[model samples]
Target chain A: MVFNYPNGKKYIPAAKIEAAPKIKKQKNAAYSNRGMTLEEDLNDSNSFYLDRNIAVIHKKPTPVQIVNVDYPRRSAAVIKEAYFKQASTTDYNGVYKGKYIDFEAKETKFSTSFPLKNFHEHQIVHMKAVLEQGGICFVILRFSTEEEIYLLEASYLLSFWERMISGGRKSITKEEVIECGHKIPLGFHPRIDYIKVIDYLYKLS
Target chain B: MVFNYPNGKKYIPAAKIEAAPKIKKQKNAAYSNRGMTLEEDLNDSNSFYLDRNIAVIHKKPTPVQIVNVDYPRRSAAVIKEAYFKQASTTDYNGVYKGKYIDFEAKETKFSTSFPLKNFHEHQIVHMKAVLEQGGICFVILRFSTEEEIYLLEASYLLSFWERMISGGRKSITKEEVIECGHKIPLGFHPRIDYIKVIDYLYKLS
Candidate 1:
């Protein structure tokens, strides 16, 4: 999936531009072996939540800018020309126990640190806006190499983002993530049981 | 703009498929006269609210399923083939004062009643889920002919939808809407000024 800014510049994520590890090959192999990506697992878990009346969360649709569309008389309209517009917000959001929940999910090959560049400038702005409105916002980071998943609050991520902007660390170390974030145990029925961590973190029940 | 179901059926809006007045030309004229659509006005209002540190609301991007892409040498990747997918949920959603806000906006030429078919089945189901989760869910109906706008709670909408499904009135009478819904006064800085109505209806100070 190629995403472009409104100005038509191709967005090359920093994680993808790295040279050391063969992430692409591993990504393909992971798909074959695991049979799902973090996004797919999250989507599945969200549906499980919905079915059980636990929460109402969904992945926002990928943003696309349609340029030219063709209406073939007897068939559905077809988009002939379009560009992938960059998203201005996080990927998933919904109402959880009467509280607004917003978050983004990302997986990295690194075992020690999660790079900050995996997120865009607009997404941070969006997270700040959500936090200001008193909504619960966070990021779910998966260290593929270590097979560990952690949920880090957006406030901590925002501080790190500020540090990065001021010429500090470009990545959040695993130790820092461990200190500030909560680990979510993977499960079968709901796949990644993130709501449990949320419940515990917020003392919702 | 043409939208389609994931099953490939073209979605002709209930308002557009109706006969009598040429809604397309008037829709185009509306864009020319007001210098915006309802979506545009709400977007402007949301930005105004954002700049003033009031609330955070946004219209989700149009959903599209990409079928083919062209990554020509040095140029940005272009979507060569795609199809618009029917949205599985309402359009605008966000957080306001620690509460989840979810709603859809529709402008109709009808002056007497608002057609039930203006909404899709999936949207109604999604609205039910939000309501069950204790989220603020409502519909903003713009009666273009009367130059009036009303915010009808999702519960009223669900009842009317049930009536429609059980061979009752296919639309909600304007009188019923006036009795059950809150009238939102049009504004300058915030455009539609719907949040004020939200504040009043929800009794949030």
Candidate 2:
């Protein structure tokens, strides 16, 4: 279950399975014929960019809250108790083509719409802040069932976020996304060629 | 004892004391009447800038390698085993005045020179990556005994770093830093006025 705070930060307080099992599930899914999940593809693409000196982007490490730790004589410090912490910002951020790029990636099984609940109020607030700072900010939407992906500008998402708060539709229609967002064609070397789309939109040469 | 990896990342493998004690030491150091240490003062300054909407900079959370975690019914997932992981990049990064700002802050007790040991090889590489991308990258050097702070650009530090590897002096003399870096005057609210120096260097209005 998701426990959301007033500021729109949701905390998943309990785990149905252990950490290793959870990771194993992801690994199995990653090996599926679909190449890899959008997240893994993005990570691999970022690594590819880094190795080639094309760009420097990294997924921020998962935030964890430590409660207890044990210091063994000659081994690594063992964390005895900790909890996952809600992140205050988006997942990906770095420099590309002399500009700061910030984005979030989300995948939905639904065919017709991207659920608004996938994003949080705080994330929208963060995107706005990045925009105000003149940073390039956006969200990558992946329709897993259809194997399609689109990059939507933060400004467009912000309007929809505000509208949802004011009693509008709970999700953005697939048609709306297709109209406003750039379609990122998947490829081999850099599986998700989102940078090409960024250059097109921002005119960064 | 600090465990130094060949790549220059230091791992505090064993905690001499509990996590609370570790934080307490930092807190006590932060409460000095003369002025907070460079790290504390910078944290305060960042908070000031954040509250005033002047900038959005943040220290990355310490990286941890989680080995085991426990799930209690209706409660948070507790990490049972983990180790502190070495960070690949600098401590602080964020948006400032429509530019990407990335930096690491370090203080030296030595009065004569800033030792090269304070910085890691990987950090130098990370700084260089940021620089190549046209990001504003630098290191804030605090001569603690002298109660002076200087903003040294990554390029300047990179030169010294390369010199050290080529059998030069193991440190950068105070005179050299003074010659190449900008002095940041301490203030009340924000404490360290480093952004003023950035504005001067970058000619950002």
Candidate 3:
């Protein structure tokens, strides 16, 4: 008996691309001048960790609400109409050393403090859920101008967030973050290398 | 100073769908008669688990490579050209009771046996990685014709897959699955409560 898949490959409902257009590799002098964003650094670090068979963390794909699709002849299906959907959880999550690791990375251009406004209420609630489940949840805050990175635990952020909602400071002071969070020195190969900090924070637990 | 996001929200890159067209909730007689597909059942179960705060499992969004995006209005950005990219990991993964749970779900109409071809090599490799990290990894097989669902451990599937590649049976017999795999009974509320099986299997270990 032959079973036909009318909607070929139900697992991957997205359009398949054939003969991917070659990307022109033109180098720009200013390309290296632009520092890597927190996302890029974390992606590079995740790849590095993955390649070495160290962990299985991945950045969840951006959610898209597809409405209309066009299947061009002999080529990939083109998404003619789609909209982005809000993420219900943090950006990055995966398993490391038999423990679940989850985190969100955010960059702040502010010189003195990180604004709590940058994070959404839903994200804080999601982090709370992760913490309740015994998963390691944290936020990687990148002080872009200062080129400093810190890993702040979800518990620390939760208290401050609750305080803010209760008519407290709207932002987390730089001094408070420095006191509460762990500093992660930047590395060349893994870029952000947040796993080292994970090791420090969650290895015992 | 107030900083306004010209793109209302930068965190969620997807476009917001305002005044979404009515879904026209017409019930198709055939759709209801045809038992819920594996994907739908799992989605329902995940929602059930999430609503009760019992677990936080989610199906990863399909990955798409966006080529052209059109900002037709100030409020929404429309994806004009995008292609789906192949996934590197299993479909469903999340933390449950402090343990990392990862699994793939597939369905076959064959009543006698479950074919191994439904799974990809990369997915098997991914399950291996998850296992190595001490995470729970498995496959949920749905025999559509028989209306039976079985939860087979990654180790069991790996053994059968290796046997097939080494000049053995290309499929796992229904009897074998029944003997080696745990049967997951269908439910009304949670649909496919595979967590119940997980609790029975891994709660102690």
Candidate 4:
């Protein structure tokens, strides 16, 4: 099952779109940037870091399978038919002060809990492999209703995912997330200022 | 101008495609995999490294700007109209054992020299930033005719690019490339074992 979230153009299975208990069509739109504020903020923050020569992280481009293309005589070729391809890795990754950092930014409208279905099975696997390879991996979770964001390590998220796999709660309560994740304060210059959290957690600086 | 080489589709400016003194559309067809063997090879090699728990490198997906989409009921969303966007960064980048690894792979069929036009000005600027941030930056240059691949440090490529801006030679002679870069031997499992070259260059081992 492909969880297409790139460019905010989701091609998710109908059942997976609102896996949360009380999610509605309008609730998803209430969040900033069509529920992708975390991504945009991270992009702004990464650009800030790159400009300052602090980090070199970038979001991977939206993956698409090109089916047909029309080459105009003297203009750019247009992709006529294409489908979103399933991403095999986490969305954001790069090197920070000689350390490998990888993570995914996810925003949820749920007030009390972050739905586990927001993540895919393959992403869990990818996160595990990244950690095994000694890469720093995590997820930037934004709870829109709470106006809170957290940088939760992949290992913690993976364990919660495993619990759900063996028929546990389908979501993690916000309290539990707060217990494990580093709260990211919003800023003006870098916007999210996630690198500060990374420096603190990884002791890079 | 955007060089659309991700899917073996050419969206190059007409003049830039045949920048070499002696080139035609027929000549581009001579290279393997529709002149995208280098990208394919690197992907294969990256997978090998990931599976072996060695490195966490990945090629960024081809960037596309989606203009229109059709979300059918209970069916996958289809991208109806899209266009290739100019890539701001080099194609491949990831973390390798605590080092940021970034690179662009270009295959040139010209026997005498590797054309500098295979690169872009922004890419040169990006390579410089990556270097300043202490990242491992380079280009994987494959001379299709010589059956040789070289990992030339981005510093060298950047110098050559600057010279081109001041009306120097538009290409780096094959002899100069051999002298400055490390020749990567083709391997069976990883296809192109570029990490070995990086390991030696950075003294990682």
Candidate 5:
């Protein structure tokens, strides 16, 4: 079961099993076959960047509320009871080349369109705040079907989200994303060469 | 009972009163009278700075491992079983004046000295990593006695920590802290005007 908060994105319970067979099949079908999930891949890429002194972006630790703990002798403390807490901002943010970099990463199987509903209202609000502060804000979208990645600026995202609210476009078409975003070519040393895109944006800004 | 991991910081279980009374009292005494803890004050200050476009800094969310979650109708998802996860980096980090700023805040009640025990080995390693990447890393120490605050650079901390391992000094002397650290003058608008100290360091660097 997934929990939907008013301001934030939906929370998919990591441990919950769906009762509906159709939905379960869909969820299973959506899972990537890259050996690691998108989060893990990003984390690995961040580590790679950090190791090479390319950039210092990091995924924020998962928020949790603690209730009980056990202190066992000669071992690490064991957490007895805790709960997941809703995050107030994006998953990844850091500094690079004296610029504040903020971004959210999402993966989609759709070859032709990316859903706007994947983003939360609070996230949009946060991106707006970052933009206002002169920070570089963007999103990394991975189209698994085509094995293509794109970096779309927060400004474009804001416009799309606003349009969605006014009953305009429900999702951003692949063609529009291709035109608006910089295609991020995957590389070996650092699998996701996002800094190159940042460099490109830096020059434009 | 507090949990102590093999390679992680020790966590004291606040709910386990019967475990150790003296330690509990000490911890409580350290935080007792402060209207807002250092972290809370810094968070408020960060929000103020971000709103004004003066600076950008944020505290990373607390790490939590979710085990089980229950999705009940019409309410926030309840996390049934979860565990606290050790953080891999500092609590607060961001960009200011094109410099990467990273730090950990700690409070001690001792009037004469701040115990080395308050700092963990992992934190030292993490600070070293930040420093190697050309980022500014420091610790904010709150001496509860005289309500004084100090921003001690990671270089100074690493030197002191090394000395402690060699049995030189168990804790940093209050006099040494005052001499080495940049004294942060408190203010009304931002409360803790740490950026002033950052400015000093920036000039020196």
Candidate 6:
């Protein structure tokens, strides 16, 4: 059967059925076969934490600017028009054991260096503000090539940002990150397990 | 001489011209100057807090889903089609004095009672999650007629919400709010001095 989308695009179900097995095989051939993206994994981890009453961290929804809507029925309102808007804050924030935790997640394909452009100016400003208010702020950096991760504190990020502005370094080197940040081991159940890092940081602080 | 809008409507100048004093008096009488709405006042107060670095709170931008946008030459992007979307989180949150503060601001025109319908199930759920995570969560209630404002903690709101579900009070009475919530005195510097209430709650907790 064929299903037509709102944009008049023809969708074929039989073709998708035929491709599903091959797509699954290809996906298994890829790294780890974790069956999820970084976003999905983190979301699941957050849910696990919430269920256990360990912490309450949430990924903020994408901001969109809406201009029109149509209500065909009394109960259903369909969005007819909208556009993505720039987010003014970090992606994730919540309270963990009486301390505020705020952070952004980023993934990089490069094994040697992560590009600085992945972080926006507003995110930097937000991190700085959180730090000034004595909240624990950090960024979770994932090197997809190496399948490794690190949690870099916002203070270190601010220093790198200032250095970039002063023409010192265009981006933070992998060595520098390894030296300054905490290495987070990949886990089976919660995936990132960043709360462990938070615990460590809290104890250290 | 006259200027017309794109819709061919007569344009009214915001500035007052040197007309006859009698005509000016008549024009002033025609318009009811009720001053700023509660939302506007709160927005101004939030901006004041932001400027002073006392708090980092912001009203989440109206959610929108855009279908079309026009980028005119030498002009900003014009959203041609969009629709408002349901927000999954509360309207306002920030870090204040080493604490994570989250809240929703609501206004009621009713003099005697505040309607429970003003809040959504999703908002209540979100507030509950934040509260469970040890974040300071609350709601700001503004009574337009009385020009009174109250800051009610999430615990109180949840209690009232439970009563609503159990066939108890359908709405919170004005007197109940005045008794249970902290009365935020309108001030000159930051306007809504909610931090005072936060300090008190912090101490109690």
For every candidate, C-alpha RMSD to the true structure in Å: 8.6, 8.1, 8.3, 8.3, 8.0, 9.5
Tens-place lDDT digits, model 3, residues A29-147:
22224544566678889888888978899888777766566666534566676666667788898998878888998877787999998798878988988888788899998776687
Q: TM-score ranking from best to worst?
A: 1, 2, 4, 3, 5, 6
Worst 10 residues of 1 chain A by lDDT: A1-10
lDDT of 1 by residue, B1-205 (tens): 2221222122334454242223333564544466566777788898898888899898888777666667675336676766667788899999999999999998778889999889998899999999999999999998876678899999999999999999999999999999999998888998889889888888886
lDDT of 5 at B1: 25
Query: How close is every model to the real structure, measured as TM-score?
Result: 0.86, 0.85, 0.83, 0.84, 0.77, 0.76
Q: Comparing to the true complex, what docking class would candidate 4 get?
A: acceptable
Instruction: Give the range of the ten consecutive residues with the poorest summed lDDT in model 3 chain B.
Output: B19-28
Task: Assess chain B of each prediction and give its TM-score.
Answer: 0.85, 0.84, 0.82, 0.84, 0.82, 0.78
Tell me the tens digit of each residue's lDDT in model 6 across B102-133: 88988777889888888988789888888877
Every model's DockQ = 0.32, 0.27, 0.31, 0.30, 0.23, 0.19
The predicted structure with the larger DockQ, 2 or 3, is: 3
Segments in model 1 whose C-alpha atoms lie over 4 Å from true places: A1-32, B1-31
Local error of candidate 2 at residue A47 (angstroms): 1.4
Residue runs of model 3 more than 4 Å from their true location after superposition: A1-32, A73-75, B1-35
lDDT of each: 0.81, 0.76, 0.76, 0.77, 0.72, 0.70
> How would the candidate models be sorted by DockQ, starting from the highest?
1, 3, 4, 2, 5, 6
Q: Which residue pairs clash in candidate 1?
A: none
Q: Report the Cα lDDT for residue B158, model 3.
A: 91
Model 2 misplaced regions, further than 4 Å: A1-35, B1-37
* Top lDDT hit: 1
Model 4 lDDT tens row, B1-205: 1123333322334564343212223344545444445666788899899888888788888887665566674336566766677677899987677678899998888898999989987788888888887788999999887778899999999888878889999999899899999999978888899999998999987
TM-score of model 5 (CA atoms) = 0.77
Which has the higher DockQ value, candidate number 4 or candidate number 5?
4
